[model samples]
Each structure stands twice: as structure tokens, then as C-alpha cells.
Target: MRPKPVKPKGGQESVWDYPRPPKLEEVTKTIEVYFNGVLLVRSARTYRVLETSHPPVYYIPQDDVAMEYLVPSDRTTYCEWKGRGRYFSVQVGDRMEQDAAWYYSDPIGRFGPIKNYLAFYAHKMDKCLVDGEVVTPQPGNFYGGWITKDVVGPFKGVEGSFGW
Candidate 1:
């Protein structure tokens, strides 16, 4: 027998209501990264994409990320909302922050949760600005919420973290 389809809670719009980040409207823009005055990553073609239930994730081409500064970590976690996530680190001038970036390359039943979104550690990023606003960056070591001063959040990343 077929069960009833689950409906969106609170009569709210489901994640599918909006286009996913990678599939969102794209703009050929410039993105840059700096750590203690040293240019880490700077490039054009930076994309302002979405991660659905998560947040807007910036998808910079591989060329834009300083691979030299990124160290892969084995820390992995499941989102139930975004799928399994993998971690990475960034180093800058003798400073290293652990697990600063994360991505879910292959999400499960991806309706809108992060499928291929790459987010950096706002706290570790010495300087990260989007279209000229110095992004405030999100908090916590495992979540990826870009919470600038004005932009607030109870972002999906941290919604269920207390159990972890």
C-alpha cells in the first residue's frame, strides 16, 4: 500500500520552491581572499549560489581556491537535511584553522539541501567580502552560516547541532 506523501510543515514553501544555488542565476563576478594582508585566493567567475535549506554558498572555481592552503580533513558528518559533508582546512602565514571549509559532493535525495556547495570558515577567513560588504561570517566549527552584522540567522546548519 502506498503511504501518504509528507507535506511541508506550517504550510510553508518547500525547498524546491526556489532554485538551488549551483542552478541559481549566475553573474560573472570577482571574488578574492586574503589572510593577514597576503593574497590567498583571487579570481573572477565567482558564483553566488544557494545551498537551499542551508544558505547561499559561494562556488568559486578550483582556480580561485589556494590549494596550497587547504588541507583535507577526515571529519565527516551527516545533515539528514543536507546529506554527508566533508571537511577541509585553510592555512595562512603560520596560522592554521582546522576544518574551515565543507562540501557535500553527493547529496542524498537532494531536493534543495547542499549538494555541491563549498563554504569557507568565516572565522578563519581574514577577509571575505561579497560585492564589497565585509561578510561577518558565521559561528561554530561545524556549521556554515554567513552571518554578517546585519544578516542574522538560525541558519539550517546549526539548527540541529545540539545533538552532535
Candidate 2:
């Protein structure tokens, strides 16, 4: 017989809690993302930009992205804390990068706030902009931190990185 299913402790969430974005605000960051010398993603879709211990990630909505450049990707990643994260690819001029963008469709109620937004790997793109100023991606291959003119970071994915 199957073991009795463990239930979530009262008031405590299971490991399926995707980190929810902060409260929505009237954010007006002029954001841009590029790849293969092409501007693949550009928008002013920054709702709540935050610089966490990880990186400065701008949570953006579906309306903000030019979906013409996006297509469904077959890749998926699961974090014990974030549930399953789905992936997408930015298609532009015949160059395609797989699983470069990700989102959580079914996060625990605690992180239910960000059910529809997405984030991209800033490094995979050739360029990015915030507020009309070109934003430099943080130094790493796997992190999406937008290090612009003012923000700084002790960002992850940069420590002890070797040339890939």
C-alpha cells in the first residue's frame, strides 16, 4: 500500500511555492532585450523591479512582451521551492535559443501573485535597456540580472564562473 500522503503543515507552504513578485506598481522602466544583434524583446513593462540577493529582475506581464518573437519551448525545470517553471524561446531572424525564458503557471498560493508574468535570461540576449538607457546584463551566463546605470549586485551565477 502507498504510504500515507504527508499534508502541508498548518500555515506552512510546501516546496511548491514559487517566489511571488512584489506588489504591482506604476513602474515605467524602459526595458529592452536583444539577441544576434537584433532587438528581440523591448518594452516598458517593468511592474515591480527589485534587486534581491539574487539579481535585479523586472517582473513583466504578457502584454509587455512582443509575443511575435516568442514560441513555446519543450523545456521545463522544477525547483523544490518554485514548482515547475515553463520555458520559451525568442525567435528572431532564424536564430533560436531554447529555454531562455521561464515562468510558473501553477505556483502555491503564497506566490500566486506572479502566475502570469515572465522573466528572461539577460545574458542570452545581446542587449537590454531600462528607461531608455542601455542596461548591461550582469556578469554571468545563467543569471538575468539587469545591471543598469545605477543598480549594483553581488549577483549569483557570477561567482567563480569559467569561460563557457
Candidate 3:
């Protein structure tokens, strides 16, 4: 069963208000990803994908990321809207996180802007920040959304949210 959507407060956005077909919008906020005490990426130019019942998933342009730390993995997954996604293993020093990032080399439909852009799994990283605010990873390991103070949700990927 779907949980009741939370009413957003001032300066907040309700995930319920997002669309079924996710929207990709350019974000000017500073997006940062860190792993093993190392900065993996930091950028003001990024895109965020917002969908109903989900927190925003921020994608950083390849140019802004530390590509050397991301080694391509053999795994792949499909998103109905975004097409096939290729995974990457993140390694910083001797520490490594497998399949910790993903990107679509050739996205479908309106998602072309995200091609070659990568989205990291916040839970696997030391920290992910948006505009300097630390983010909480979206519930469950399958989704890569990042939860922040400005977004409200009884979000998908939580227990009992599989059918949502």
C-alpha cells in the first residue's frame, strides 16, 4: 500500500508532486561526493532526476568527477525511462566499493542530457552533499536517490514500498 504523501513546508518540496515520468533539471547547487576521505567529485553544474515517491538522484558530468577512481563494472541494469545503465566500482586508496556508481552511455528519450554523467550510491560513499548539506541515502540498496532537508517523502525503496 502507498503511504500518504507528506505536505511540504516552506522551502520544501513533496516527492508526491513529482511526475511519473521523471524529470531531469539542471542544478546550480554544489554537489559533492567523497569516499575514504577523498573528494570524488565536486561540481556546481549537475543534473537531478526527480520522480514521484523518490528523492532526487544527482548526476555529475564526467568532466567534474574523478574518473580514475571509477573502474567500470560488468553489471548493468535497466530503467524504463533512462535505458540501460552500466555500473562502476569505486576505489579510493585500498578501500573499494563495488558497483557503487552507474551511468547511461546513451540514454533514451529526453534523458540524453545525462549520457556519460554518473550518479553515485550515497550509502556507499563516505558522504554526499548538496549545497553543503549532508544527504541521507534513499532507503534500500537498489535506488540511488539522495535525501536532503528540502525534500519530503514517505519515499519508495523503504520496506513495504516495493509495490509503490
Candidate 4:
């Protein structure tokens, strides 16, 4: 059963109102990722994916990410709406996060803008920011959504909500 939708406050958007298949769109707001006391990514040119019961997932342009810190990983996954996905391990200084990032090299038409763009697991990073505001990672190890004040949710990926 679907959880009761949270009423949005102020300018906040309810995740329950997001579409099922998800919507991908360009975001001009700054997106940043920090780990191991180093700034790994900061970009205003990025894409965001919004889906039902989930927060937005920001995809940073490959050019904005520190590629030297990203080592390709053998792990792979699939998203029915986006197509194949591949994981990457991020290393900065002596610290490393395995399979902490992912991207789609060849996404379906609707998701084409995100091709080759990287999305990180916010919880795995020291900090992830959207529009200068710190983000809260969507609960659970499998989903990579980044929750911010602008979005409201009783989001999926929380304990006992796996079937959502």
C-alpha cells in the first residue's frame, strides 16, 4: 500500500507528486560533493532525476568531476527506464569508497541527457550539496537520491519500504 502523501510546506514539492517513470531535467543550481576533506565536484551544469516517493538525484557532468579520483569498477546494474548502469570507485588521498558512484553510458531517449554523467551516493561522501544547502541522502544502501529542503517526502528506500 502507498504511504499517505506528505503535504508540502511553503515552496516545497511533494515526492508523491513526482512521476512514476521519473523525469530528467537540467539544473542550474550548484551541486557539490566533498570527501576526504577535498572538493571532488562542483558544478552548476547538471541533471536531476525526480521519481515518485524519491528525492532528486543529481547527475554531475563528467567534466566537472575529478576523473583521476574515479576508478572504473566492474559492478553493473540496470534501470528499466534509464538502461544499463556502471559503478565507479572513488579515491581521494588515502580514503576510498567502493562503488560509490554510477553513470549510464547509453541511456534511453528520455534519459539521454544523463549519459556519461556521474551520480554519487550522497551518504557515502563527506558532504553533498544542492544550491548551497547540505543534502540528506535517501535512506538505504541501494538508492542514491539526495534529499534537500525543497523536496518533501515519505520517500522509498527506508526500512520496510523495499516493496515501494
Instruction: Write candidate 2's Cα lDDT for 67-119 as tens digits.
Output: 77888898987755446888889888788887777878986545566576777
Pairs of residues at least 3 apart in sequence or in different chains that clash in candidate 3: none
> What TM-score do all the candidates reach, one by one?
0.61, 0.68, 0.98, 0.98
lDDT of each: 0.57, 0.61, 0.95, 0.93
What TM-score does model 1 achieve against the real structure?
0.61
Worst window of 10 by summed lDDT in candidate 1: 13-22
Ranking by TM-score: 3, 4, 2, 1
Tens digits of per-residue lDDT for model 4, 1-164: 78888899999999999999899978999999998988989999999999999999999989999999999999999999999999999999999999999999999988998999999999899999998999999998689999999998898998878777
| Clashes (candidate 1) | 1
Clash number by candidate, in order: 1, 2, 0, 0
Candidate 3: C-alpha lDDT? 0.95
Those runs of model 4 whose alpha carbons end farther than 4 Å from true positions after fitting are none
lDDT of 2: 0.61
Clash pairs for candidate 2: 30-131, 34-126
Winning candidate number (TM-score): 3
Q: What is the lDDT of residue 136 in candidate 2?
A: 64
lDDT of 1 by residue, 75-101 (tens): 998866557888888777788878877
What candidate 3 gets wrong by more than 4 Å, as runs, is none
Candidate 4 lDDT (Cα, whole model)?
A: 0.93
